[model samples]
Target: MSRRRFTIRRPRGVAEYGAAALVAAAAVSLVVRLLVWVGEVLVRWWPVVAVLALLGIAVGAWRAAAAAREHTARAQRLSVLRFTLAEIDAMDDRQFEFALRDLLIRDGWSARQVGQQGDQAADVIAGHPTYGRIVVQAKHTKVAAKVGSQVMYQVKGTAGPVHRANSAVVVTNGSFTRDAREWGDRHTIGWADRERLRSWAELGVPLHQILQLPTLARRRLPGTRQPFPAPYERTAPEGRTNGVR
Candidate 1:
């Protein structure tokens, strides 16, 4: 049997107290030195920092004002500008896409012209609160020309999968060939040919009214191959067809 003796310790002495005081004083001195160093840095670089801050603020304000002006101008144009087939035909491909974007905007949807070198077949993308997202492929061509099935293939392949759009459409100031129309119909791809374009752009028909969409307006359109009539079956050489790709 063994009994253990326990001892209670208190602060060592003045040396220990002095050491603790020295540590506290050193920490305070270090903090004060750090603050002074930081102050000196701010003083030396204040001009450059101020210039950068002013430049950033100026740039941000300029961009905001510019965007506001552009939006106002666009809204004005949507209300006032008359879009004719002749005017559409006169436009380049890029301008044609912009026209589509404006038309979408006019119809109470947020729209943007996304056509470029690598646009992934989406010339104009739009969203509506009720009708959901739509992706369009703008094919600008002569009245005599037609948009081919290749364009439909492009839009159908990319619109739903890549762009996450609820509807995929190929729009043209020209018409779609029988093959193109048939292919589009089979794949649930919408066609906005010259007639439909006139209705949407010129006559101010809402897009949802012009196109035959699924009954479930708000649902995401399923990309499926449905049966569509292919009349007057014929094939032409890829480059020689009287259609724009």
Candidate 2:
């Protein structure tokens, strides 16, 4: 059975107004009495209340400021990630190498590009303050293309030895195949995939700054090659006329 409940309607004239005003007055009186009680309490324990209140305010302000700073940092990182992804997507192979070198310099490295017609195409050579010297192999591939094991091996074998590098890294705008990544990991050769590269650009977190490989941090001993041998002045890669990408 369907049933409709009847609602009692309140008069919409002076009676409603009078009832509302009475309720309002009673509410105000209750609030006033509460405030009076608080005032009396405060008179007795004002020192304790003041100290607690001030401490609470300070803690709240510090937390709010910290949260605001963290929020701003996250927003800035997201903005940079967007711009970096766009640039990486558009850059050609040569542009990618030189750009990587520039990024290394910005993140506190003496960086240069290895320009050669045939040398396994080892891209950039840079020196890290903490990690010493490291050779780079840059691969600017389409997003879907996965860097394979053969290329990973070539760079792993060549980049470090050819330049007398303490360690080697392969930088890619595309991702690596599982086999390639595993091979590199086993050999202590590092790589930066697309998303990782974006974080590097966005957060100013350069690779050379973070690796914990004992060999990477210790090489370039007293008489050996300088951590940063003559940083080749920055320049566009050879045969670049069409501009970026």
Candidate 3:
């Protein structure tokens, strides 16, 4: 048997070159038609595309501005004020309550002054997203005149049942009587005398840290009823509109 071999050859002349040119021209024509269709479509819908792009940019800018404002407000709230003990002492009772309410707001609580006649021992009601609700009693008095245990008695009796407070505190610009301190300790009520108040108002110590209260597990005491649904007063300062969660 004889083995046969085959050889491949390139196109020889004009006929072959003309066929190749026809294929290339067809390809170019197809590409040009496709590009023309795309360009017409883009020209016809250019206004809509531009509007969508502008909308996207406006939405992104709005979100970024909102985030920046939130950050700035948070920083302003966290910044410590230059408060002095003399300033605190000079404040009237109502002014003192408002000052403490502002301090609570600075410390990230939605707080307002409620100290008035028939306030039920709650001078301030504050709510935190993490720590729940707290009631504060403010006493503005001279250093020589000390806050007594009666303040603690009043707070312990009414803070939970009347105001639905998770924690109760009495803050004073004067010293606390020994009996007052003991009473607050016994009942788990927090008392901040002049020095402690200075630390909180001036040094930016958070009230929760000073009170030593737990953050999570916002549970009521055994046999205690649920907190009142309408704990916040209608007049929330700084445009806060809602009650405690």
Candidate 4:
């Protein structure tokens, strides 16, 4: 059997090919100019040619720099997005409310938690003395079970009597209904959906730190079941005894 030899070919990108073509064109033009000079018929356009060449180099460098900056920005945004998702996943309903309130406070708003256990409409009331009062209803539902128009109306109704605020803001871990968003728009209410929450979390905190909260709790008590002791066990601790008394 005869063995066939395979040749490897290198691939060149458009930018690489374009740069090569530019260098080749410049070399060819220089050679042509040299030939014309030898024949004593060289054009007196050296200054113009020099300026064009400089312009071409500047444009190429600028394009390369712009492309690099775009790539870097995309990578940073992706990193931020991943960090935000991790933070969201680590948070429970109460923790999420705390995080949201912290973010609002960081943004220079005076935030106060209302009735955490049984709040009718708003979970938090945040305000800037100049920007007026803003009512915040922070919901930590799964992506599928999002707050809809009913919840929005409920909040609006509850907020009307509770506080005559300037604006009502619903911040949730999931998204809002299209109708809900439209209703908010019509009623001049603000909706901070999942994307906005994620963006804020990314800006305010790191993912590693957020994830570390649960990990730290688990590490503090190795091999321990939660709810500490079941409710039944708490009521009947003696029931588990093998012998009497």
For residues 1-245, could you state the per-residue lDDT of candidate 1 as single tens digits?
89999985554899988888898899999999999998997899999888998999999999999979766755554464447788778777767777777676666667766678999999877777677778888889999898888888888889878888888889898998999999988888999999988877766666776885544344433462411111222222233221111
Report the lDDT tens digits of candidate 2 across residue range 30-117. 9999999999999999999999999999999999999797677556534432236677688878788777777676656788888467
lDDT for model 3, please. Answer: 0.78
On TM-score, the stronger of 2 and 3 is: 2
How does candidate 2 fare on TM-score? 0.59
Model 4 misplaced stretches (Cα beyond 4 Å): 1-83, 204-245
**Candidate 3 residue pairs that clash:** none
Candidate 2, pairs of clashing residues: none
Candidate 2 Cα outliers beyond 4 Å, as residue runs? 1-83, 209-225, 237-245
lDDT of 4: 0.61
Query: Can you write out model 4's per-residue Cα lDDT over 1-245, one digit (the tens) per residue?
Result: 99999995543898877888898899999999989785553257766777888999999999999979756754554443333556565567766665565555545456666636668877777655445556778888887666789878977886656665556778887889899989987875677777776655554432222222122121111243431211221111222221111
Local lDDT at 139 for model 3: 87
Alpha carbon lDDT of each predicted model: 0.75, 0.73, 0.78, 0.61
Assess every candidate by TM-score: 0.55, 0.59, 0.58, 0.48
Q: Backbone clashes in each candidate structure, one number apiece?
A: 0, 0, 0, 0
lDDT of 1: 0.75
lDDT of 4 at 36: 79
**Best-fitting candidate, scored by TM-score:** 2
